[model samples]
Target: MNTKTIKSVRLSFLLVGMAFLLNSCFNSAKKTETTEEKAKVYPSDVIPIMEQFSILCGDGTSFKDLIKKEHKDFFYVTNDGVTDWVVYKTPNSGITSRTSSNTRTELGQTETWTPEEGGKLTGTLKVQHVSTSGDARVAASYSVVVGQIHGKEGHENEPLKIFYKKFPGHKKGSVFWNYEINTAGDDNSGRWDFSTAVWGYDMSVVGTSPDTYPAEPEEGIALGEEFSYEINVYEGIMYLTFKSKGHETKTFTKNLLKSDFSTKEAIPQQIWDLYAAIGRDGVERENAYAGEIQNFKQGAYNQTNGKNPEENIVWYTGSETYNGDIEKQYANGCYAEVWFKDASIGPGSAPNKQ
Candidate 1:
């Protein structure tokens, strides 16, 4: 071997080393890209408090482990160019809870407490869309429930249901809350809900004809308008506070242990008008939701259904469900969508302390 041969061998060794180094660097870069692509943003990532709750998708899928989990097209997180929002979306018709005919993509609190042992839930959200294919004469049509305090026992009635509703072709919608009575006897068929307005008209305001609409509320909330609500159930009393920019702040109080509609005469004229068509004039129990286990639910609980409104006026929205086909319902504007930028759940606070 001469000096030239030794130089040639040395040069080959250097070239091989360079090639190996470049290959290794390329592989490392590819691995990092793969990992980044696999990463996903979940609702629980946006809202850490979601770990304390379980989720029910509009397709009737239930999930107890929500940490870092998401259901596509139902419960997920998205950015609106300014802020990340957790979206809750559901169609007009889908597989619903056995107890309900309507569908929802909502979170149910894992912990349960009685009215006396209270709880508090808060959310800063906006309504994006509502079912646009329901009869205007139906009260529950074109509405979505944003938050609820649902009874776990007894008639399993909802003590509170916060709603956002808009009639088709209307730019502004109404924000309201309803309290369903715990019926006195086993016949739950006579159960009814009484509504109170928060920003616009209450649930009782509806069109005379299926396609007609009432006068647009002057102080109503429009779609994509931001609003916040705090439900603090403390010491058997529910204290509600609603706030929105450029809108008047409203506060309300109602006792949970005592029945305001225990007698037929105590029933509000609104209830009589809304429920009388269905023969649902039953009085509430003497003790309204007292000692009943209850939990909080937050998200989009779609109120529209496909049933004929003539069968039951208050419910039975007579919307176009497309035979429970979620995709068709969505494409045809028969869906509900809500976005929450902030939310929290914890123990209730005393009225004086709040």
Candidate 2:
């Protein structure tokens, strides 16, 4: 053979070898990229995988329910149609894997996940499908964390000390004052008391007849009578006393901490009016007016009364003694009193007549 022919043949062989090597490298790279993308984790896919574990619950048992009952402080739920477990650990604590003996096996294969101090537990569940093709399987997994609970002090059966305040206004034609009582810490059965100064002024000062007033000074002021007073509070209890000429003297003790109290953002106008009207009367009158006032405040006014002004006032009236004229005057005065009371002292301890 000629030298040039030999050289051309050698070049041709080298070019073919180079092309084959390049094609092999390209195919290998493509396969690696496909594998990496498929391996990425997805929580939704994993949770459904964990539900397979629920198969263990077939024997009249629920693994999820059991976990919730055992550790109410720690629980997990998944929306991705997958199963997950989560755990939280306190500092300096460690978790140990539960053994077969530690888990109840009556239902099926189940495990108790534990956490260590400063450690967190997480679970991710997924399912696998076996293909008809021999030895071919598709699988997925999920992640979750476990939680820990701290114990609280006091036994469940221990009695709790309740504290409250009572604001018993004066009876009609009597002085006005506020009295408090505590049923938890001090004399639970003691009556409350205050001084004449705390009782403020007598209803007689306003042209009202004291003869119609309550036998006790704790009663509120009469209609058209207005008074204010301050009651002292020491610790949780209060001591009050009063004396009148030709009348029996009395002393009362009460604790404010034992009174039941709730806080509301606003007091309705009708409630304020009803409270004022009742305050002008005695506890008996107040109790009687409660239902009527509640109905009025709830906007359930009598239709017949709405047609006639006089009937309207009477129908709205909480007391039989209050006529249309008296009700109008009482309502106007009550607006002022209610605002003053609510602003200055807040909702005082008066029983919910309702």
Candidate 3:
């Protein structure tokens, strides 16, 4: 072949080789980028127990992959760049359990326990938002339930309801606990809750109107603040400890085997003042929740709802539900968002020191 023609052919081959090399590098880079994205930690990966439980979303859907994947509008994972959190975001008014008006995007334990054979549940979480609507006089206004020990048998009354409440324009919110009475007789009409303030006012403390504000709590929790709680039902005692930075650590102990409010006279003065407005004077079972099958629920079990507050001031908030449209209610600031960093469930352990 002529020298000039051979040189031209060699140059053409050289160009093709260069082009192939560039294409291979680009493909490798793309593959690496996709791998890194897929390897990113997800909500379920951080929450190890998700595989052991069921999740109920704020939009009224129940699924097992909530933690493993993202629901976008409801359950998902987010990072503050410091820590990862599994968010339980549910609307104030949406489809919920048949027995509850409030909606929740939370985890349900697979196991159940009774007072006689106890179990324990623990979690560390933060509240991001609560319903902004509700009458000030109604106990559930501007509040959300973060955790609970719901009874499964009998009237299915909740033995424990942990709450976070803040009034409008307030700088901080209150953290409190409530004990729902296990009805003494077949009638459940007279049931009442005895609230104990942990860091702020209890459920019984209410304002005079929907807009009227109460005195700011001297010590209250702010949004995005972190708190820890351990509900240890060791033997027959329900030992609870609540801890947070810049706040006093509170501990409480209650007997599940015996009834503290077996009779009307045994009810605390707070009950009389709080429930009298609603005509709730129900007495507790003589044995309280003894032998009752109970299970622990951890997540955003919203306390606020869209029912008329006057109809049932204790739980009905009449918050905007957008006619049960979950996404719309979420957009309208009618939802509860809770994020848990860590949690555990197991057989009851020995009580921890205060």
Candidate 4:
């Protein structure tokens, strides 16, 4: 309690008060910055689909943390001066997910189900662009897969690959759905796709050469057009319904538990015509994708890329690549763009027999 001791105590209190004041100012500044950031809304913020599924944005980034923020080269929001749409844009020749060679910026359903214990998935989207630099002879060239029903077990085959494709000289694009048959035996090489068209020729239809063009599909879809699909898997049977504004509404039913392509004679004529030359006439397993785990995915799954044209002429697109630069690819039409206005997922119900 001496004079010098009292002065020392007062100074210590003053120093402590100054330190606390500075800390408060720093915290306040940080809060203000965070509030400003939160003020800006994003597509995910308005849609909030991340509450159920995990998103893989374009540019190979996962939307686990920054779901509310837009990534310029990937997932973002855009309005056509009327309604907002979530755009999923991915380069045809850029970084992709670990499990896939093809680039995809999509939302994967966290849950998995089986054919007997069925599930449902649906998507309403328009493909704005697809790479136009692929080998014309190849079926998958210049195509983009918009939705998928990917199998998680037993060969990991994709049961459904919904595609939109337009060749170099075509005015309209074809919309088709392919079903990859589960191999009948240990040789996975026997797998093949049975594609059926919604509004145009199936995936089997292709030009005769890399530059030659086929006759335009009279009923095909065009760019900027909107379409929808419903995958109602009830009681192990897949009931598909597809609809568009000015196109015919199509409905299909397929048995997932049994193989329709078990014999050569059972193979569809389209498959024989498309795959016979490529040596891919394969039969499905007797017990097709019976007990395998499956899940749903929705987005722009860019099927075209920088793979060599001579490698696999069937699936390799041979798209333009500016040494793997994404910006350049986007400018040269080496990307896939899709916008979804509305989407949903839940239990599937019985299909109405029309």
- What residue runs in model 1 are displaced by over 4 Å at the alpha carbon? 1-39
Using all chains and alpha carbons, the TM-scores for the candidates as numbered come to: 0.93, 0.17, 0.89, 0.86
With candidate 3 superimposed using the best TM-score fit, by how many Å does residue 236's alpha carbon deviate from the native?
Answer: 1.2
RMSD of 4: 4.7
Q: In model 3, where do residues sit more than 4 Å from their true spots?
A: 1-37, 65-67, 352-354
What is the lDDT for 149 in model 1? 98
Q: Which tens-of-lDDT digit does each residue in 1-354 have in candidate 4? A: 999999999999999999999999999999999999877667666566655677786567786554666778688778778777888898877777776778888888888899888877777888888887878888887888888888887788888889999987778999999999998777877678889888888887878888887899999999889999988888788888899998889988889899888887898888777776557877888888888899888888888877775766677767777877889888888888988877778777877632
RMSD of each: 2.7, 29.5, 3.2, 4.7
Backbone clashes in model 1: 0
Using TM-score as the measure, name the better of candidate 2 and candidate 3: 3
What is the Cα-based TM-score of model 4? 0.86
Better of 1 and 4 by TM-score: 1
Model 4 / residue 266 / CA error / Å: 1.8
- Across 190-291, the per-residue lDDT of candidate 3 in tens digits comes to 888889999988878888887787898989998899998988888788999999998999999989888899987898999888777789998888888988
- True lDDT of residue 111, candidate 4: 87
**How many steric clashes does model 2 contain?**
55
Could you give me the TM-score of model 2 versus the true structure?
Answer: 0.17
Model 1 C-alpha lDDT per residue in residues 1-354, reported as the tens digit of each score: 999999999999999999999999999999999898567677887888998899899999999999878888999999999998999999998988989999999999999999999999999999999999988889999999999999889889999999999988888999999999999989888889999999889999999999999988888999999999999999999999999999999999999999999999899999888888899888898889899999999999999999989898889999999988999988989999999999999999998987
